[model samples]
Target: MSDTAAERAYRNCVRNLLAQFIHAVQQQPPFILDECDEESLHYLEQLESLPGTTGNEYAELGQAVVCRTIAAFPHLVPLLPRDLLWHFGGDCLHYMPDDEIDKFQQLDERLHQAIGEARPFDYERERAAIFGLH
Candidate 1:
């Protein structure tokens, strides 16, 4: 099946977030890499080498790194972008409660609607509103 508009938007968000993350790690490699397991490092290496690739190309590897980071270094969880968990879905969902998932789904729907209408959509602001953050 073809991807829906929402799916495309979600993929774009994930790709942008993942790229930002990779850039951050590249900037301060040792700080993050010293704690990563061999598998995570390998995935990061693969992802880092393919700069500017589409989300589909590196998303699974990005997901692997995110999942491994959560499992191997729980303390780093806060450092990792929270939106990535919702955008990546699959194994990443294991870390989020059902309520949080619902909120993310709602946020995505709102984002899609905004896009469909050509209205401005501030993702972080919308997300904070949905999550009841100040």
Candidate 2:
């Protein structure tokens, strides 16, 4: 294949694989990466780079990374049996309860209002409401 075609194929494959791994990590918690193709590793470097980039570019990069991961790893589609991935991802990020359930209730109300206004959820909100939101 040509260089572009090769890169696209590699990207697609990595996306799919990482998507599967991510789903596994969420569902199973602490999933291991025994090994990965060199291409997969390279793509992961790029995908992970999103969190380091500045400003809204990070969000754009995050979206691209997710899209690529999904495109490459269709297996993850089935693993997401429900919206539970959000909760799992949040847990992975250590979003434990702060003060009490009441705090969360207030946040949830605010979230619903913001969501109703069509404002996209921030990472925290997205992570918290994965299964609950959609």
Candidate 3:
């Protein structure tokens, strides 16, 4: 089946967030390594090896990374991009409040509508506007 607008948006979001997550991890101090449990470390290793991964693989790994962080290294959860949580949408959604989820749902609907109408849609700009980000 052809991908929907929401699916395309999710894949793009996951890919971008994975890169952002990797960059954020690289900037962390060596001491942070001491904080990761075996599972978290394993997920980090897999995440580092994500170059050339397919969209489905990126989604799975992104979900794993987010869930593992919430479970093992809660303090570092802030390092993850919030959009990743909403894009993957499973246990990840549990991390978001209802109001935040509603905003994301609206964003997805807007993306779908814009794409359907052949209008230009900028995901980041729309997201920032919805979330009231400057």
Candidate 4:
């Protein structure tokens, strides 16, 4: 191929890759990690380790699952990447700005409820909204 054609092809490949990555990342895939199992959860609950709140499993989890799970469990907070935590942080690490605090609290509550009830939610739009990608 000509140099111009080769350059165009390479650029197209990069664009295609970027589109795919964005699509996958925006989908807010489930967080049913291999380690978080029902058997273990039951054992933890029996041991009074898992707080009895929602009494639900984290199956088909939503985008907020990561944050909400960490909140519900608290122990997982340290496991999360600092950047991901910052991505959701508006000002302080745990609080949003004054004007948006209400909305932030509302969202937090929703995540808590979802995590408690193990509700399945497609957070593609939510993720996109966070990054202002779409």
Candidate 5:
């Protein structure tokens, strides 16, 4: 296959795989990635880049990341690169309901560390950890 075609095919596969994983866990999705506005994307990007370990920064980034990741769960429909997908999903725990948030964290232990830490995140490392679950 040509590079473009191969890439397209791969994305489709990733989308299906991740979407299935999300479905299995039964968490509420935060948003449709494709339908998200630039404003939303910008917010997510900022959350991803936010420095960890400050007052409330860890929780803030974790909620932002998890909610966006789940809300934008369908981003997998486009098979976005793992790093990009995970990057947009960064943030703390306030946006989602409390009951669901704990389950979400329980679904992925690394998610807990990523959000709990008080330092800058490592997306590549996050990807390596979660891709195993997918």
Candidate 6:
């Protein structure tokens, strides 16, 4: 389906954020492997103790890096997809010049409410409803 202009804008902004995040992750290791201590070492041991023990920290590092990177893009908060916006609570991590958390929260609330207005699709029933013949 074709997206509306606003939707396109939102999607593009998110894609930009994702692109920047990926670039950052590629440039830096996901975590401070050099900074690991007794506590962190235990955490790693516990992680490795789990069923799948490939012993690589890449997955965990990748997640932390992605989250931190996303958090950096605060300006993109208001334009994030509804699902992602809900998850972030309207906070974008890195977009420092525009971190109006309250404003983004308000926008998130309104957008989610609008999303809630869309009922589950029922082709035949919806067609009848639109034609006033249900």
lDDT of each: 0.71, 0.45, 0.75, 0.39, 0.44, 0.39
* lDDT of candidate model 3 versus the reference: 0.75
User: Any runs in candidate 4 off by more than 4 Å, and if so which?
Assistant: 1-96, 124-134
Report the Cα lDDT for residue 37, model 3: 67
Model 2, residue 81: C-alpha shift (Å)? 10
How many backbone clashes can be found in candidate 2?
6
Q: Clash number for every model?
A: 0, 6, 0, 0, 21, 9
CA lDDT of 15 in candidate 5? 47
Clashing pairs in 1: none
Off by over 4 Å in 3: 1-14, 29-40
lDDT of 4 at 44: 35
Candidate 1 residue-wise lDDT, 1-134, digit = tens: 13655556555676677678767655554446557567657756765654455467656765676787777656556667889887667799999999989999999899878767766667767778999997
Q: What ranking of all candidate models by lDDT puts the best one first?
A: 3, 1, 2, 5, 6, 4
Q: lDDT of model 4 at residue 19?
A: 43
Q: CA RMSD for every model?
A: 4.3, 15.2, 3.4, 17.1, 13.8, 14.0
Candidate 4 residues 75-106, lDDT tens each?
54444433333323532345234434554445
- How should the candidates be ordered by TM-score, best one leading? 3, 1, 2, 6, 5, 4
User: Runs in model 6 with CA error above 4 Å?
Assistant: 30-100, 106-134
Candidate 2 vs. true structure, TM-score: 0.36
Estimate TM-scores for all models: 0.69, 0.36, 0.77, 0.25, 0.27, 0.32
Prediction 4 global C-alpha lDDT: 0.39
The C-alpha stretches of model 2 lying farther than 4 A from their native spots are 1-35, 77-109, 112-134
Give the per-residue lDDT digits (tens) of candidate 6, residues 1-134.
23544344444554454455333332343224566456545433442333232224543443343344355534433433332332233233333234344445544444344345542333323324443564
On TM-score, the stronger of 1 and 4 is 1
Q: What is the Å distance of residue 107 in model 4 from its true position? A: 0.9
